[model samples]
Target chain A: MSFVDMLLRAEARHRSRLCVGLDPDPARLPGRWRGRVEHLYDFCAAIVDATADLVCAYKPQIAYFAAHGAEAQLERLMAHIRVVAPEVPIILDAKRGDIGSTAEQYAKEAFERYGADAVTLSPFMGFDSVEPYLRYPGKGVFLLCRTSNPGGDDLQAQRLADVPGQPRLYEHIAALAQGPWNRHGQMGLVVGATYPQEIERVRAIAPTVPLLIPGVGAQGGDAATTVRAGWRGDAAGHTTGPVIVNSSRAILYASTGDDFATAARAEAERTRAALWV
Target chain B: MSFVDMLLRAEARHRSRLCVGLDPDPARLPGRWRGRVEHLYDFCAAIVDATADLVCAYKPQIAYFAAHGAEAQLERLMAHIRVVAPEVPIILDAKRGDIGSTAEQYAKEAFERYGADAVTLSPFMGFDSVEPYLRYPGKGVFLLCRTSNPGGDDLQAQRLADVPGQPRLYEHIAALAQGPWNRHGQMGLVVGATYPQEIERVRAIAPTVPLLIPGVGAQGGDAATTVRAGWRGDAAGHTTGPVIVNSSRAILYASTGDDFATAARAEAERTRAALWV
Candidate 1:
């Protein structure tokens, strides 16, 4: 099945559009799971176990695991997720971009080595940098469009003279995504929920492409505004678009105390409930 | 010492401006060393030992190691480089980019876990995405600008209306690198050697900043044009600018026979000599 089809099916099965980010920051882990890289795995496993039935997908940011030299642990976590929550997809938030041949290796890293269903990519090098990842038929690739960070305005918001009416670079990227660059039907855009206006603009530009909306929780994005702007409905007024809202630190470190797993599930439940509006 | 200072010192000591990329592809490995990830380490170790003295730096593309689930072997190769040739620097060619907090973890991954002297970064998300990597005082970060791929023209060549004369996006990035983004004197740009004209423009925009010029060998980048357009000279005609030309497959798999290491050394010597004039 295509990534979008699988995503829609998972969303329907879980009755949620939430993607819990498994960014296992060692410092923010609970007291019981505080020390080694092994603790990192335990923390992620506990979060996955607690929130598996509530979320549509799990997003693992590769840097957190890579910082601790824990590729094997990450692999184990992916395996654990596969066994425990087989229906939920895994999106490796690696944000990897490179030339053609090196990109093929990264495609192998995300898909073959780590066994992720999708991966994030940076489109700075343009088409070829992202083309290799599209070769995998069922996997998805999310291109960073308008990020939630404060410095995102530095470049992504710049006006392009070559574009008609001098549209902003991010909008230009959205148009490209709607046009030739997305031939495989597996391409998506990452427009942060922090900027609802940009989300609306991106949604208008690329109406049907999936948008991995981060910044909904710890990054201070309003759930109402994000859902109102990004959540497209069918003609029957049902929320049918692929807007996977992600909550990373808010859900991962809901309570640093002993009841962290329960707190994470509660937080995930709350976020999922809010998205229903 | 800063990255530029160390790089220039290495260039003066070795009298070479070549950077050999350690992208270990299993299919290209010699017949005897084609089995496990340990063989990957041995293959890279042999290449580094053979050509470390002939080049200014070694760039190990992270995807190749990550593809084979061999981060430990990559770490071992880096440690070996530190012990074998202490003067040469290692640029972990991980084109990583993300928001600020995630960028910090990637910074740790490159500087702390991998022990690389420098790293490659994608500047698509702008200032903050590249900020965390700048925290390490002595390390280097090369921002992508006009990559050597055919798809580079897709986005980097777009004209920005905000700039004075609507210069191309890559030139705008060059200007930014020469200006505010490079406060610590450790920043550089990756302008492909394949496009010598773009190299000339980038060289003019950021005269003193280092340029990591890839695509010199198997990518079909002309050595003569690369040196002529990239190499800067002082009033006395002494070569002064930092233009580290890179060749990966051509040097690494110079001969797939029994004398692969010897052939690699010869190829590195040839490329290094070509960068002089």
Candidate 2:
């Protein structure tokens, strides 16, 4: 199936816009599994089992595993999902960007190594930096546009006073990605929920491109506002595609106790309720 | 010894501005070692043996190893260097940028896992992104300011219209790195040698900070111009203190024949001689 179609179906089946982010910071992991991969796997597996029905996708940050020198474990973790939650989309949260050959290597790593359904890319290197990933059918690429952090405004929001019309850099990136890089239509924009205004503006620019909305839970973004601002209000009036709301810390670290899975499920249910309403 | 002092001493003793880049692209490896770690080890060891005296530092791009699922080989490659050329500074070429917590993990990888004297950083997330690496004493942090690629100018050279008096984005980054982020004075900038004019401008902005000049040889940068633009000019306008010129593919892949080491050594010696004169 096409990446978009797959996402839409997943969203409908789950009746949820929630995306569980598996950002396993070892320091924050509960109980005796602090540095152990088995403990990490158990924790992640339990969470997946509990919240699988509530989320449309699960995003595993590659750095977390690479940090542990447990690349093999990461492969195992992804393979386990292939067996367990085979229906849910897996978006590997690796913000990689490079030119030509190097970008190809990263594309292979995210797609071939871990077998992620979609991958987050750093569009800082321009459109070609994203082209290699598009070659793979049924895979999606999320380009960083308006980020969630405070300092995101530093370079992203910087305007070209020297240029004629004074265009914001992020808008230029959005236009370029939408125009040329979206040839395969598998491209998406990572518009952080923290900036609703930027989200609305970017949505207007790249109306068809999907928006991977991160920073909802731990980053303190309001779910309703994000959906409303991000939702496409075209001639269809009630827009209904290309936006996946993501929540990481709130669901992943719901409980430090042995009943962590139960707590995670509760968190997922709460987030699902908050979104569906 | 402190990273800055060690860099200075290494530069003086080597009597060459060369910095060899160890980017062992798996696809580009010889057919004999087509699909194996031992082949990578042999290739890297040969390069180190041939070029240790000709260069001040060895830079290994982490992406090449990470792409091949040769994470174990990365540690082995660095250890190989420690055994062969212990005095040659190892600058792990990882353009890592993340939040405070994640940045610490990257530092541990570059410092503890690979045992690099310095690591190149991508300053996309602002000061907080690089602070974790700088906190470690006797370690060098070379932040990406202006890259050599065509599209690099898209964002790095952006100017804010609202803030008319503000410096170009890269200039602001250079200043910030030199200011608060330069805790140990071990901070440096990776200003590509391709941009000689920008190199001169950045040198003025970051006069005291060390510069890691890449883009020589295969990248089409003139060695003489790079040395003049980066180093200090005395009364007779002679170049001075701590600048390492890097050349990767041009030397390492100088030959695909059995005399590959001899070819690599010849290329390194040629590059070294061209820069000094």
Candidate 3:
């Protein structure tokens, strides 16, 4: 099945738009796993099992695993997710961007090595950098647009003078993802949940593509505002536009004790409830 | 020692500006190593040993290693470089960009886990994304400004209206890298050699920051034009501004025989000579 089809199906089956980010920071691991990089798979597996039915997707940030040389564990985690939450798609939040050949390697790493259903990318290198990822038949790629950080304004909010009436860098990315660059209908835009206004604008430009909205829980974005701005569906509950709102720390470390997995599930349940529109 | 000082020292010691890129693509490996992922380290280590005294720096594109799930081999390769070429700095060509916290993980992956002397990054996420890496005192960071890819024109060439004189996006990055972002004097800009005119423009805007220029051999960038545009030095051969011209495939796959490493050394010597003023 296509990535979008899997996402929509998972969303409908679970009645959730929440995507739990599996960022296994060793320093924050609980109990015996605290500061133990070896348990990256163990810690993340428990959380996945607990929230198996509460999320439409699971996002594994590659940097977190790579920081501790835990990619083997990440591979194991990907397999574990496939077994425990088979319908839930995994998006590798790698944010990779490169020229054609290098981009192909990253695309392969995301799809073949880790079996990610989708991947996140930095759109800085432009269309050719994004082109290789689109070659994969059923995979989806999300381009970073209008990020939540204050410093994001330094570049993302700059106006492009030569483009007709002038659009901000992020809007240009949104338009590209919505139009020409998204040839296969497999492209998505990542507009942070912290920027609801920008999310609305991105939704206006690219109404139907999946928007991977981060910054909701620990990053302090309103869950309702994000769904209201990006989610579009029919009265019969058919989602034409999808919003995958991601919350990492708030759910992962709801309690930093031995009941971490249970606490994570409770938070995921609460987050899912909050995001249900 | 600071990464810049280390680079300058290496450049003077070697009398070369060539930055050999240790990108080991399995299918392209020579002789018995053909299509073998296990020999990633061996292939790269051989090249590094052959060219250690002929180049100022070594860049290992992370995607090439990660694609094969050979990151552990890359770790061993990094260690091998330190043992074989202690003075030559290593640049981990990651192009990583994210929000603050996530950026921390990537920074850790590059600096702590991989022990890279420097790391390449995508400046799309703005200052906060670039800020975390700056915290590592002696290390250096290179931000992608004007890339070699044709798709780079899509974003980097766009005229930013809000900035005075409608400077292009890459020019804006050049100004930032040369100005406030160089707080610790540890920042550099990556301006591709394929666009020599753009390289000159970046040089004129930034003036003193190191320019990591890729796309020389296989990508068809002119070595002489690249040097003329970015390299600056005094009569005594003391470089105030440095240009690290990188070549990967041309040297790595110079021959497909058992004498691959010797051919690689010959190519590296020729490349270093071509870049020499």
Candidate 4:
């Protein structure tokens, strides 16, 4: 299925816009899940078991696993996630962007190796860096737009006179990404929830383009505000089409207690409930 | 010593401004050094031995090695390069950029694991992404600016209103990077040879910053024009500083013949000789 159609189906089935971000930070992992890949697997499996019904997708940031040389182990973990939550989509969040040939290799790794439904991309290497990944029939490529970091404005706010009007670098990226480069309707923008105004601005321009909204909970971005900024005026208020709300630490690190999976599920439930408001 | 001081010292010692790029494509390797990690080691060692005397630094683009699942083999290759060309700096041309924590891990891998003198970074992650790599005293961080790709103008050409008087994205990056972020003087920018005007504009603002100019021989960028562009407008129109000229495929693939090292050295010599024009 196309990313849009899959997203629509998943949202309808789950009845939620929430997408849990599985940024498995080793340092922050619960005590029971520490020092063992098996434990990590169990923790992730339990979380998936508890929250799959509440979320449309799961995002696993690759860096956290690769830090521990857990590439092969994480492959196993993802397999377990698939078995546990067979219906939910997996977004392998590796913000990779490189020259042409190398990008093809990365595409193979993300889609063929991990079997992810979508992959995040860093557009710094230009469209050629992303084109190979977009070649996959139904896979989604979420390009980095206005990020949540305080220093984001450092380069992102820079204006180019060559384009005549429309300042901010992020706006420029949004403008170009909406067109010929991303024709499949599978392309998405990562608009941080912390920057509601910019989210609204990006949403205005790239109306059909799905926005992967991160920074919702642990980053102090209110979920309700983010949904409004993202879904409001989103292409004639066809509210369901173009936004997937993401929460990482807030859900994953809900408790250091052994009932961590239960805590994670509650956080996911609360986050999912916020979508209706 | 600081990276700037190292560059100055290299310029004085070598009496040349050349930095050779080591991008070993398997298809381009000579018959003798065709496959396996051992072949890569021998090939890289030969290049280092042949050209170390005439160059300021040697850059090994990590992608070429990394594509072969040779991530572990990089240490061995770096060892070979260092043994052959100890004094000449080694810049691992991995354009890595991520969040602060992830950047720290990449820094560890580049500095601690591979022992590269410098590493390239993508500025998309903001200054925080560059900080971890810059924290080390003697290491260099080359930020991507004005890339050599054709589709580079898409988002890089966006104009932002907040910065007042919209500058092309690269110019704005150069302006911000010039001042507060000039930690240890280890910062350099990757200005492609194709954009001479942008190069001049960036150079005027960041006069002290060293530049790693790629796209010379193989990528159709002329060395003579680049050298002339590197000349700071002093009273004598002389630049004591060196602009690291990079030639990857042109040097590495000088010949598919058995005496590839000899041909490679000849190419390096011819490339260096062109700077005088």
Candidate 5:
């Protein structure tokens, strides 16, 4: 299946757009797992088990695992996600950007080695960097659009001259992804939930493409506003345009006790409810 | 010492500006090592041993290693580079870009775990993604400016209307790297060698920051043009504006035979001589 179709299916099955981000910080691991790299798969798998039915997708930040030299454990966590949440898609949050053959290798690492359903990429290197990943027929690539960080304004918000309407950089990227780049409908944009206005703008530019909005819970973004701006549905509530509102730190670090998984489930449930609203 | 200082010291010590990119592809590995992921470290280390004294830096494309689940081998190769050629700086061609804590984890992966002297970053997410790496003093980051790939024109070559003079995206990055964003004098720009005019433009905008120019050999970028456009120095032949010209596939696969390392050295020597000219 195409990744968008898979995302919509997960959304329908779970009845939610919440994507629990699995960013396992070693310093922040719960209880005995704290500061221990060995428990990366264990902690992430437990969280996956707890929230498997509560989310549309799971985003595993590869850097967190790679930083600890625990890629094999990440491989295990990815497999664990597959077994636990068979229908839910996995977005490997590896914002990789390179050219030509190097890009091909990164695509392989994300799709072949890690079994990611979708992977994030920095669109800075343009379509050559993106083209390699698209060769993986059904996999998706999320280009960073209006990100949540203040520094995002440095480049993303700047107006592009000579492009007919003088669109902002993010708007231009949205238009490209919606038009020329969406030949396979396997492309998406990552617009921050914190920027609900920009989310609305991006939605206006790329109406049908899915939007992966992070920063809903812990990054001080208003969930209801984000959903209103980015999410689109038919009268029967079937998705017309998809949205994946991701919450990482808020869900993963909900509790630093042995019952951390349970706390994470509660957080995921609450986040899903909030995104639904 | 700052990364630029280290780059300059290495350049002067080696008497060449060439940076051999250690992008070891298993499919193209020489002779007995062909198509063997287990030999990633062995192939790269052999190349380093052969060319250590002939170059200013060694850049290992992480994607090549990560694709085969050989990040451990990458760690070992990094250690090998440090041991065999301690004077030559190592640039981790990760091109990683993310936000907040996620970006911090990526930085730790590059600087701490991998022991990279410098890292390449895609500036798509802006300064927040770059800031975490900057936190580690003495480390360096080379922002992707005007890449050699054709698709780079998609976003990088666009003009920013709102900004004064309507600077192209890459030129705006050059100004920032040469100005406010480079407070610690630790930032550089990655301008591809294929576009010598753009390299010259970047040099004009950021006269003193080190420029990591890739796309030299196998990618069809001219070494002499790249050198003339990007590199600058004072009368004593001491560094003023530094440049590290990179060539990957041409050097790594110069000979797909038993004497690959020796062939690699010859290619490195020819490339180094070309850059010097």
Candidate 6:
């Protein structure tokens, strides 16, 4: 199935658009699940198990696993998620981009090796770096449009001259994603919830493309504003758009104490409830 | 020492500006070393051993190793490079980018775990994605600029209105790297050799910043044009500028027969000799 259809199905089943980011920092893991690589796996598995039913997808950031030299643990975590929550998608947040054959290898790594339903990519190298990921028709590729960092304005916010009316660089990217890049209908844009205005701009530009809105929970982005700006409504005025609001640290490290898993579930549930409002 | 200093030192010592890319495709491996993970290690080690003395650096593309689930092989290969050719730097061509914490993990992966002297980064997510890698002042960060691929034109070639004369997006990126973003002075740009004009343009934009010029051998980029456009000379007219010309398949799979390593060394030598002109 296409990512959008699968996402809609997951959204319908869970009645939520929450994407729990599986970023397991060793220092922030629960007391019992700290230090070791096995514990990392256990911690992420626990998070997935605790909140699988409440989320549309689980985003496992490749960096946390890579930092510990525990790719095996990541493999295990993804496997566990597949077994426990077969319906919920796995969006591997790699943010990888390269030219030609190297890009193809990354695609294989994310889709074939890691079994990600979707993989995040950087569009700096333009279409060549992204085209390899698009070869996988069943998979989804989220191109970074407007990120949730202060340094994001360093380049993404630059105004483009070639574009009519001189739209910003991110707007140009959104147009590309909505146009030629969406031939397979598997493309999405990552517009940060922290930048509601940019989110609103991107939403208007790429109307139908799914928006992976990060920075909602721990990053201090207001969930209500994110929903207001990012949430697209159907013709009948129902807010049924494919907008995934991700909360990593706020949900994962809800209580670094012993009640981490329960707290995570509670936070995820509360966040989902808040999104509805 | 910083990456530029180290790179220059290596270049002067080796008397070459060639960067041999160790992108090992399993199907393209020599007949004797076709399958198995150990063979991949052996293949890369042989390539390194054969061409180590003739090159300034070795760029190991992460995708090839990640595809086979053989990151251990990559680690071994990097370790082998250290043992055999300690003077030559290792450029881990990961092209990784992400927001904040995630970028930190990738930085760790490239610098600490892989022990790369430098890493290639995609600037799509802007400065935050590239900043983590820059924190290590001793290491080098080469931002992707005008890529050699046809699809690169889709975005990088778009003219930006932010600059005085409305320079292209790549030019804006070049200016950024040459200015504020390169505070530690460890920044560089990856401008493809296939587009000599773009390489020349980037060279002019960022005069002193090192350029990792790829697409030389296998990608049909001319070496003479690459050297002419990419090679920047000091005011004293010495070719001491940091411009690395990379050749992957042409040097790697030179024979694809029993004499693979020997052929690889010969091709590296030939490519190195060509760069001098």
**Which candidate ranks first by lDDT, i.e. highest?**
3
lDDT of candidate 3 over B1-277, digit per residue (tens): 9999999999999998899998888999999999999999999999998899999999999999999899999999999999999999999999999877789999999999999999999999999999999999989999999987888999999999989989999999999999989987899999888878888899889888999999999999989889988967669976547899999999999999989989999999999999997
How many clashing residue pairs are found in candidate 4? Answer: 5
Query: B14 in model 6: Cα distance from truth in Å?
Result: 1.6
Q: Rate the local accuracy (lDDT) of all candidates.
A: 0.88, 0.80, 0.92, 0.77, 0.90, 0.87
- DockQ of structure 5: 0.90
> On a 0 to 100 scale, what is the lDDT of residue B225 in model 3?
82
RMSD of 2: 2.3
**Number of the top-ranking candidate, with DockQ as the measure:** 5
Going through the candidates in order, their DockQ values are: 0.88, 0.52, 0.89, 0.38, 0.90, 0.76
lDDT of 5 at B220: 93
Interface C-alpha RMSD, model 2: 2.1
Looking at model 4, the pairs that clash are A159-B160, A160-B159, A167-B159, A167-B160, A168-B160
Task: For candidate 1, please provide the TM-score of chain A on its own.
Answer: 0.97
Interface RMSD of each: 0.8, 2.1, 0.6, 2.5, 0.7, 1.3
List residue ranges in candidate 6 displaced over 4 A: A234-240, B234-240
**Please, what are the lDDT tens digits per residue for candidate 6 over residues A1-277?**
7778888899889988899999998877788766665688989998898998999889999889987789999998999998999999889998887867888889999999999999998887778788888899879999999887887887788887777988988898999999888867889989888878888899888888899999999999998789889876668876534789999999999998889999999999999988764
Clashing pairs in 2: none
Candidate 1 residue runs with Cα over 4 Å from true position: A234-240, B236-240
Model 5: residues with Cα > 4 Å off, grouped in runs: A234-239, B234-239
TM-score of 5: 0.98
Second chain TM-score per prediction? Answer: 0.97, 0.94, 0.97, 0.93, 0.97, 0.97
RMSD, every candidate, angstroms: 1.5, 2.3, 1.5, 3.3, 1.5, 1.6
* Model 3 DockQ (Cα-based): 0.89
Give the per-residue lDDT digits (tens) of candidate 2, residues B1-277.
7777766666778887799998887656654765564577678878999888788889988777777688887888889888887777889887776665557877887887778899988766667767788778889998888878887776777776765466787887777677767886878988888888888888877888888888999899999998888877679865444678899999988987777789999999999988885
Per-model TM-score, in order, reads 0.97, 0.94, 0.98, 0.88, 0.98, 0.97
